[model samples]
Target: MAKEQTAEKGITSRAEDFAAWYNDVVLKAELADYSPVRGCMVIRPRGYRIWELMQRALDDLFKETGHENAYFPLFIPQSFLAREAEHVEGFSPQLAVVTHGGGKELEEPLVVRPTSETIIYAMLSKWIQSYRDLPVLLNQWANVVRWEMRTRLFLRTTEFLWQEGHTAHATAEEAEAEARTILGVYRRFMEEWMAMPVLTGQKTDAEKFAGAVRTYSCEALMQDNRALQAGTSHFLGQNFARAFGVQFQTAQGDMDYVWSTSWGVSTRLIGGLVMTHGDDVGLVCPPRLAPLQVVVVPIWKSDTDSGSVLEAARRVEDALRAGGIRVNVDDRESMTPGAKYYYWELRGVPVRLEVGPRDVAQGQVVLARRTGGKVPVPVASVLESVKAALEEIQAELLRAARERREANSLRHVNRDQLTEYMEAGGGFAYGGFCGSPECEVEIKERTKATIRVLPDPEFRSDPPPASCAWCGKKAVTEAVWARAY
Candidate 1:
């Protein structure tokens, strides 16, 4: 049957062709697919479930940090986006405009938001009246639209799901602190849950968000050695407040523009996860982020003994589920045990338990980890073993990713050496930048490398480079430069 071959067909090898491998894995794994709409994608149930887990985890963090969830209009008045000059110019080219409404020409065209900073600030102005309302923390989980000429499934789609956090504060210091705080949260989430190591630092002026006074990000290196900006937190200072008339009366009877910040992480994170830990076999999800932490596939010598094995598998599943594990029992009669193993492995289930007639008789089950290890545990200890294996797998994934990042990363001292190395194949290259836009532009033009992040001393693993890598000028700071996604 055609269904049987779905698991038989293998994905493209990541080493031979990484991009093709990514697309093949995404389609073969049923995570996502192209849509009729240009540059858009349909997130299948498999993919959407991963996103749901991401949403729940992030929402908990946002709430614990005093941010409340809210909704805003999907359509923004064209004039509203034009309120901030830099913001408007930055997003204008990507804006999808709507002119007709209700079978009639609208009086004013609307822009499907590229980002919600402009429109959200418009509402904030009315909500905050005095210093008592200075810090207004809000977050929204929503889909946003941006017209794109080129697109990839979860990486660069025209329409994508994301959570945008917007906050308003009374002073520059408070706003800056809020941005950094969220940046730290993003770093923690990416490292702990996703098990992807990241370099947290500031973006160069050329790389910062439009109209932001400063932008900080957690830049992660993919398995292919390219950089992915997994998350960003931007400090808007007084720009959005001034443009949108968001001001609160001070306790001293004076009115001043509110300081603002905005930060977001999108489905692009799904892409990062795929690239960061995936291999030639398929996706290898960390236990913490995996939708199905454990899958029990019952094996049997014959259909005569299948019921017994299935029963054992069910008992194992029930025990894991009771212990707070997301477990699935593969009891399909149509598939072989090998097919089931291939199916769950391709889908990146973290731990797989195989309960066969012999194992059931012996009161043991074979434990196979997605991270490439196997063991046998007594049936009585299945729950405890699964718990321990999941924890061990989670830690190992983070450690392995960190080791790979360090291995692929390179250190360079000058432009020539960096360009030569990048021309061959690009990775994270630590070096010094002169902090000149010209120098940055030249490197991008020649080697296609951008400053991924300017690392803080504590985050930098090596001694600082003495001079600019792109220009032989005095170095402003040590930077991790790479060709990015």
Candidate 2:
């Protein structure tokens, strides 16, 4: 027992040290590690596996919506980025430029893509010649570089992998519809698959993407009571098409520029998952995204009973695997069963099965849930039990997260109240806004919170009741403000 305690001793208590607990889990869980380069991280196999599951689920959703995958160059020409004024101005501060190559200085510097809108739209200009090519739905899975002053692993790294979907439509309405549709996909992915609750809405004009007419996002409340913009969809509204000269001939003997949209979800979401569901012990991955949903461990007191325990564990593993569950059996002889428990728990496997000599003798297995605690299950019904338990754990996590969100959220009219709440670690604060950049700036300066999103038009059955939170004038919209990651 003393030896076992030593192996698990280093993880910091969550309440005592939240930041250290997070870093410990990220490193001890074998998910990610600090890289030699500052502001960069190396995602290990366990972390990459979670990302792979996410990619597979999201790819299916994209394909279902008439989107196709494609690749773009890693570097975008300086001239291409300059084509869009707002985009260039917004991204200039974070741009990583390559001034030299092949031991010589280049005439025009190339930028590592902070985002792919510029480069992709430039190609769309050439591919779209006629109205027949009106709607080009393409997405790319790639890595982008953004020079951040401070970084945190998957949450704010200098370089991270993501998928960006860029689409061209014949009309503004179609483009806007596509943006909302993708936003729905993101909401569903976060709520149903990842078991994370999110608030879906539009960004304020001041907070919208640089070149977008409107931007939609799904924001999730972290355990720390701060909001994370999990994903965003932007309605370009001909901005990029006009900049890139992506015009197509119309059927009525005329020509018009295409309307475009771009949306993305990045590795930052992995961080959201950690902060939202993880506890003091380690990560508590949702069943749908857990790379190994169940792990079977065989416990034995002596070498004489090892063969029987191993056989029984393998049988249980095969049963789970046959049920379409990702299962692994840990049969390493050198490590004790207690050590194996700590190892898999740190890795965030959602469920674990213990098949010891006693359990095998009784024709049963002991089940342990990573999200909570232990449950004893019979071998005959082990498959069904595991399945039901996984579903329950997933639902419970979402429900718990939703409750935390509700508890932390605040709706206020007074500016003093807003500032006080934010200073005390606020969640989502909803208030009336005048839709002025100055008002937005004032709020940001007073309280380190920005306008996260505005309530959807369809949800606004009631009008704004009072003046703007920052300015004393008739409010135009109700917006959510929060300290964001």
Candidate 3:
């Protein structure tokens, strides 16, 4: 049996040691744990359950939008990756190569896919023959490896699981429209389902995907005042189609290359959940995605008296489960009720119910919300009360996150204000740029912040405005600068 440690104080008391606290919560909450490998983790049953719920929600959304699931090879030929120039340069540093197979060295090395664009497009060429065969929409859920210099569990691991969607369209306009449609799906999933708000915008030239003509992302601000790119959708604009010779016959009897798009959201979102809503007490999971929304613990003075308390607890659990809520009754005799509370709170369970002799006599159960303190709910109205409480907690978390983002974001016209903003907890800093690479470079050197995104349609600076932040020339467009993750 595993040795039990003494119940520690709540997480709020140790907010200064966030990193250590996070590690503790992950293990204690039974979410995930370190594996034998250096930078890999084993997602325990509890963690996998949460991921399964997320996958089900997303898969349903994808299918509703006319996408089908498919699988691709885990290994891609080295030559395939080199087909796209910009893509090769961007992902080369992260590729894990395989040089030997069947116990012998091979002539051509294979690379574990960092992203599946190369292989997916290679097949797309053969599959697309005419305009009738265009608009191929496919998605795959699988594990990917990206050799990393630093690893942090789900946030930046060497290997992680995610879903990547790739599509082809007959026309450039159609492809662009598909990209935006998927971006909307992602925004909806993150905000409505995950209960985390985001900033949706286009990526700057320097920040776009390696081979994409344009990239759109949903960015969320973490509690640390840093930005996390939650998901991305890219418009390939015939780059992959041209490289792989994917062509379709037009109505006019002319052959033309197909336009492509790809978008993805990875397990890194779990990290966003931990950072955005998590308090000093531990993880604060949004109700929609929480695996076990309500846990009921029965308290008794002795094993003989446990029968009555257990009956009351079970009755309450049945009522909650009937209301379409995920509920669990903790009837373990090995630990005290206080210890169980600590465990579930660390795991971010939204609500907890305690039914004991005294509470049963009063026809009520002691309810404790993870976000707020304890309250009492009548047994008769427990179902409605829990439903309302969970919704309230979800809203409170989103509001708090939005407030932090607003407080940290800054707009500046000069260097002095920019520096002041950075020192006072950095966030999105807006300033004018002349659309020159030279000015972009100067800004990065002066402040460690780069242009994260440029306004679409390119907002030009009006006359009589301040010069560029770096070049001291007439500015072109206002840009958002920040130190990104």
Candidate 4:
């Protein structure tokens, strides 16, 4: 992370106001800033580096799953969007259409990409002519415009960056498997790399993607006890394939429309990272994803000692770098060592090594873990000690977040309890849903809460509830409800 930015003197305590506190952390840490255009943000160097790390991890996962990387056009012909009725209807409200180009009105308007599904399918139809081309696994990283009315910097924005994966398969089973597999990949990354635990499940009919047969997601709870839909994978059973004529010959030599799937995770995750682990002081970035994992701060009392301390600091930095850690040495003349600690903590550097005249003389330095701890380690052993501390911090964050989510959650909640909890306090509530959109809508209307997911086996209530949580009717299935971001 960049080391020169100054953090604001005060942060709104999360208890004072979580929304305000979030904004304070993002701006004060120099993660992002407001741009000239409304509803847009300029990702600063530190923020972009975090996003870059996230992109690389996800890209590698996609490739390992046998998916290819490709690019699609940003502008789609207006007629292309209408090829799929449900898709067009769902996106119509947010579409940004371009009617004039080169200072003259084009014969037909073009739509800025809200997603690449429609355009990708149109090209797939042209490319696939036989059974051998049964599975076209591809993903593209690109920017999308959704024209959000009210936007939050990384959570919701008018235009944002993301990776969208599109694949075509000969059978519905293959497509369904692909969708589920992607969701698993997302879950693994969230827990292993980001150190954020998540629940996986299928979204209700009312909440599934525009033209999807089914949609699955990874939902994570923020520190404030609100749910965040972190990522989604959709199974499209010949919906887009039929609309765009993406057909292939079968082994029997018959032509049939192909089943398809699409999934994606985006920049919104950066916001989730902040909420998941950040403290009142500043961001507490997960070590695996942090751009600068270790920041070495050199201390001194006099000019004579300053030179030796800085030399020790540089040597420590080189050793850590050689050990494959992202490290930075701060030896600026103006800022005191104490100021450097505050600055790095705000930026979420996972570990800090403090070197001083005394420590250098003793051939040791004070090794500090950002999560909270300090120990003295001999100069010769700095690399190994720092690596172990980083791993411990990563595991500790995930463990703490999982415990918090469980502590605040409830099961078998009734209508009265649901209403009271949502109004007075908020957390995940598991109960039965009647499998009716009308019933779900009524609950939302009254409580401003929605079903997060019909959770997977590990998260479901043991011996599920017998009646609907809201209507008191016979239960159809269990669902997790929460006020979400």
Q: Per-residue lDDT tens digits of candidate 1, residues 184-289?
A: 8898899989999999999998889998999999999998888999999999999999998998999999999999899999999999988888876788888888
- The 10 consecutive residues of candidate 1 with the worst lDDT sum are 1-10
Model 4: pairs clashing at backbone N, Cα or C within 3 Å = none
| Number of the candidate with higher TM-score, 1 or 2 | 1
Model 1 deviation from native, Cα RMSD in Å: 2.4
- Model 4, 181-215: lDDT tens digits are 99999999999989889989999988899989899
The candidate that achieves the highest TM-score relative to the unseen native structure: 4
Off by over 4 Å in 3: 1-18, 302-304, 455-474
TM per model?
Answer: 0.97, 0.95, 0.92, 0.98
**Model 2 weakest 10-residue run by lDDT:** 1-10
Please estimate how well model 4 matches the true structure, expressed as its whole-model Cα lDDT.
0.92
Clash statistics: count for each candidate: 0, 0, 1, 0
lDDT of 1 at 280: 69
Q: Cα miss at 195, model 3 (Å)?
A: 2.0
**CA displacement after TM-score superposition, residue 168 of candidate 2 (Å):** 0.3
What lDDT does candidate 4 reach at residue 369? 86
- Backbone clash pairs for candidate 2 read none
